[model samples]
Target: MATRTASCSCGQLRIEVNGEPLGVGVCHCLSCQQRTGSVFAALAAFRTPYTVTGEAREYLRTGDQGGRFLFRFCPVCGTNLFHTEEDVGDRSVAVAVGGFADPSFPPPEASVYDCRRHGWVVLPADVTVYDKDPE
Candidate 1:
């Protein structure tokens, strides 16, 4: 198992994972773009038992599919660090890939909401793309 740590811009909030992510993906949904203030959002999902440090503020939003998502961010820097789906229980947490600040972090395995993907954005040929959330 490898240990990886991700933190907010101000380093006030941090998440430490004990093992590699169970899955990595990029989402191009409109909400994701707005949430990240970027063309898309890249995330890595990890099983529970990870560690979190520092104070965080949370925001709850409803997904396009009507599922609730709870996002946690650093209260100091206002950086969105991670999120979890309300319907999924506490089995996993999705962390923003940029928080790791590692260029070598694994590439995304899936691209969701490709229907909304920016025309200028190009993904690796090997990535699995979904026009929308996979059924």
Candidate 2:
């Protein structure tokens, strides 16, 4: 199995995961836009056994689904590195796909909160779109 590495903007926080992620998705919720400073956020979910190094600050907030989620970011650069949704269980952590800094990283398979997406934003036809978190 191959491994992938992801890091914070300032390189202060880093993590390594073996093999492919359990899932990859995109979110267009208002909270995601504020956190990413973009219209949407794309993430890859990995379970335990991944190695993490460096320091990060945790920010817990209510999710779009009314559930609480924890976001981890680098203190120095304030990079939104990863987050964990209450529905996804504690064993899995979802890291921003852009943190890998790889253009060829797997494309998002599912897109949620599509109602919050911008009019100008366009997604591939192959990707599944949900008006809200289908879960």
Candidate 3:
């Protein structure tokens, strides 16, 4: 159970994970790009009860699958940094891979929502590519 720490650009928001990721992936959905202000969104999913520090700004939005989601960010730097779900309960939260101080985080195991992926976006053939999460 190795713990990992994550923090926002301005260090205003921080989080710690106590175990391996439940799943890791890159999301190319339009909503994700718009929210992250990037071509894609990469995340590491973790179980609940992780420690988090600092203040964060959050907003509720609907997902492509018609599910409600909460986007969390660093209030000071306005960096879209994490994702949380009411259905997942308080025990778990998804951390944006970019928020980690380490730059060598594992590559995404999958690329999801590829239907909306940018035309120029390219992924390795070995990576699992899905129109959306297969499960």
Quick one: best lDDT, which candidate? Answer: 1
Candidate 2 per-residue lDDT over residues 45-91, each given as its tens digit:
98767787999899999865588898989999999998777765768
Worst 10 residues of 2 by lDDT: 83-92
User: Residue 13 of candidate 1: its Cα lDDT?
Assistant: 98
Residue-level lDDT for 30 in candidate 3: 83
Candidate 3 structure quality by residue, lDDT tens digits, 16-94: 8888888788999888888889999999999988887888778998765566678888889998878787665776688
TM-score of each: 0.97, 0.93, 0.91
lDDT of 2: 0.89
The CA lDDT at 60 in model 1 is: 100
What is the TM-score of candidate 1? 0.97
Cα lDDT, all candidates: 0.95, 0.89, 0.84
Clashes of each: 0, 0, 3
Q: For model 2, what is the alpha-carbon lDDT of residue 92?
A: 79
Clashing pairs in 1: none
Those runs of model 2 whose alpha carbons end farther than 4 Å from true positions after fitting are: 86-88
Off by over 4 Å in 3: 133-135
lDDT of 3 at 13: 86
Checking candidate 2 for backbone clashes, the offending pairs are: none
